[model samples]
Target: MTDASTVIAKPVSQNRAIWQQFRTHRGALFGLIVLGVLAVVVLIGPYLWIPEKLSVAEAIKLKNQGPSWRFPLGTDQLGRDMLARMMLAGRISLAVGLVAMTIAILFGTLIGVLAGYFRRLDGPLMRLTDMFLALPLIPLLLVLVMLFRDRVASIIGPEMGAFALIVFAIGITSWMSTARIVRGEVLTLKEREYVLAARSIGARPHRIILRHILPNVISPVMVSATLEVANAIITESVLSFLGLGFPPDFPTWGRLLFDGLQYMQVYPERVIWPGLAISLTVLSVNYIGDGLRDALDPRIRGR
Candidate 1:
């Protein structure tokens, strides 16, 4: 017979249990490792391998050279060190994705929670969401950029202004889907016993949402956040490819792709590097989202 002390199982905290479930997903584990490694490289690699500080003549002399011991990724047409540029570009790309996703998640959650909790407001708020959904995303982005890019650039200087506009554009356009998902979840949650119990106790709407609704809905929101990051990165890349993003001098992954397009025939690696980076980053984020969805769901967490 087992001793009572030995038979008794210690309880696991919610966070610890969730982490255990998350770790069980091999794809998620791999994605997390890859993303962490990339983040470290982008953060520290630039200092070790400085990019494009050579004099104009010296830079010109190094143009179009293949990778060597000095330049591990080869020099671009303008003779900037490819490795350094890549690190800098990764920083910007990741920043854009994270910041934009934050904005989208915040706004979407607000809209979703409000609409889901208040039956009186649901029709109008959902209709508004529908209106946004009906709009063509790419065309709207182009128009927003064309109309505001020059004015914003003049006010804040080109690089910062462009970053702000792109982030804003992607954030607003991407929130609709998240809103719909969250709203659906909230609608189901609000009718649950705990939410109804909070209502009976004279808790305010805001308090009820904060204490009960948001916590319950976080799983889906996290999944949406991951997808938003991937989408924002791709959108930024497209804008840069079209020459509508950051100025030519400020390197982003997308801009790097555009610059390398001309040299593709002679030095295909120029395009391959950035393209591969974008694809792998997006793929990793998608895997992470898939894992989070499974780990966060009450029904699936243990199974």
Candidate 2:
């Protein structure tokens, strides 16, 4: 007896309400705008300046130069244009964040959903997650990178090889938190009336999980994904700073930060450029995640 328009209108109203809630959070709104601008610049800016590719080697005459019309950002110790370095670094940094988060989310969600939905799998899987959680992250990362970096580099080329190893290291390390969160959410959702109803009808476990459980559990997964992006970026930065990440010639924001530290006393702009990019990118992602969390939760959205 319900009208089609009524169903459509309800969803439209909810979407509008969520948008309004997001917009009202001033920090979140600013973050959305800033992130949008950053995405545009990093994705499109490189192509616009065909003469100044981000990967080009340094110009010796421009070495250690300050901000000028020719090089608005400045030149680094190696004479590579700082602006170009930044653009290219952003590409690598952003890619690492996204890809690593995706891998973590996949592993975490699979483990979480299985453990939470099926009682037989809960103890063992959760114990496995805990074991991973207990390991010291930095030491494990160092060991893994040293062990596999050469082999991976040879297979995938140096830049991509390092990239794969770093992403895998991060993905493996970072998924524990997501698994815990998703498991808890699934435990709660699997007990809800709709799930009970689905079970009562003799629905298969897989069908119930796919049709009823996953949709309800997706909000937490999305929030976790946003936070994971920031975590991945910071992890990559740490590796690069330690000289264990990208190839020497291949610049990443973290590598730039490491290189600039020695000259911090002299041209502070060297540090400033890469440092600002990392900070802004991470901060913006965090704020956007905050807004998304509030927007997605009906209880929080109204308040």
Candidate 3:
């Protein structure tokens, strides 16, 4: 009989190995550190910085000001503090990315598992996935926002309504790729000996899927989630830049970009700040995902 310590030790060793593999990827390690730093700064920044409660007349005095000890990042065209705005925008953008990815992963996993596990569901669900894949993503998102934004804004307050609409639109639309990946993984996993053994024993489908299939498929799902976060951020940015995402007064990285566009020639830093934030964030997430894909796969990890 196996000892309890042996079982525990084996898992610990395996996790250590996986972490070692992840660390070997320099890009991934860098991304992890950068992301951590960004998260911490954004979370604590507003409390520390304390944006001034300025009236329009007072705000006008600070408008178009360059960086100084007073405002490290400088002031925007409207005299808003760039550093404070950056921290706030980072919080919103990161929140959107994480929330949207969660929605996509949950929905995609459900559809993919059902389609892959049950023979009856395979064809129809796959076809539905295909139909969604064929549609133009930007156009569909635009249509969704146009159709529902006003009604949603009315039901909830405008800010929250826009947030929900943007997150849902991005999440629902982005799941097709994840669904396809998960379906393929599930198809292969269902044919494995353990799964066949579970089926032969008359285990319920739900039980088998929960106990066996889902755990096996988690690696791919985790990798997909990272990519989904980047996709969601970029999508939200696009919508905001187009002036359809959030209310004008509500600042997001995308909104900052939109506002800075007109000032691009004169105050180029206005455009640069938000643009760099978006680009670096997306790139970091993609690198992290790439590293995770390698670290999570046994074959690659072993190498």
Candidate 4:
């Protein structure tokens, strides 16, 4: 029987090993820190500044004002606070990306696990996932957004229409990669000795999957989910810029960039700010994802 001291020491040792692995990748470590800082600023910084309310009219000021001590990033054409809007908008954009990816991961894992574990279902399940993969994602999103604009708005309200659209669009298309990855992992894991041992021990199929299979396979799924956040955010921005996303009243980084596009020649900063935001956010996420992939995989660590 394990003593209390032994139990406590085991987790501590495991955590130290994980940290050692994570610390080995300098770029990933930096990316992790950047992501953590950005997430905190986006989630908590805005509330501290404007706890009273979020008013469009009140937030607006001198239009096209260049970066000043007061405005920092400067005001938009609508005279809204650029910095404030950025902070606020980050919350929505990041939230949409995360939530959408979560939905995709959950759904994809379910389908992949079932298809891999059940030999009979593999062909049909994979075929359907392939169909989605075969289609052009952007054009399909465009058509879906146009067709379901009103219905989507009705369900989630006008304020959240763009966010909802981004979530749904990304969720649907993003799952294909996850499904494929999970399927591959599950197929390999299902063949392992532990799985056969679990089966021989009178473990039900569900118990075998939950207790033995998912644990070994979930690392790749986590990395895929992180990378998907960047993809979903970029896709949302693209849709919003095309005017197929949120209304003018709702300000996301994409819509801000769209509004600034007309003034690109006159006021390039307008375009620059939002574009930079999108680029940095996506880059940071991707870097972190790469880091996680290396950290979790022992083969990569050796290199």
Alpha-carbon local distance difference test for all models: 0.91, 0.88, 0.92, 0.83
Give one digit per residue, the lDDT tens place, for model 2 in 4-77: 76685434577787898888878789888988898888889778744353443446656789999878888888
Query: CA RMSD for every model?
Result: 1.6, 3.7, 3.4, 4.3
- How far residue 157's Cα lies from its native spot in candidate 2, in Å, is 0.9
For residue 291, give model 4's deviation from the true position in Å: 1.2
User: Using lDDT as the measure, which candidate wins?
Assistant: 3
- Per-residue lDDT tens digits for candidate 3, residues 7-60, read 854345777878989999999998888888888888998989997788999899
User: Model 1, 31-70: lDDT tens per residue?
Assistant: 8988888889999987777664699999999998898898
lDDT of 4: 0.83
Arranged by lDDT with the best first, the candidates are: 3, 1, 2, 4
Regions of candidate 3 where Cα sits further than 4 Å from its true position: 1-12
Q: Supply the global lDDT for candidate 1.
A: 0.91
Cα displacement (angstroms), candidate 3, residue 139, comes to 1.2
Candidate 1 Cα errors over 4 Å, as ranges: 1-6
Each model's total of backbone clashes? 0, 0, 0, 1
Tell me the deviation in Å of residue 79 in model 3. Answer: 1.1
Clashes of 4: 1
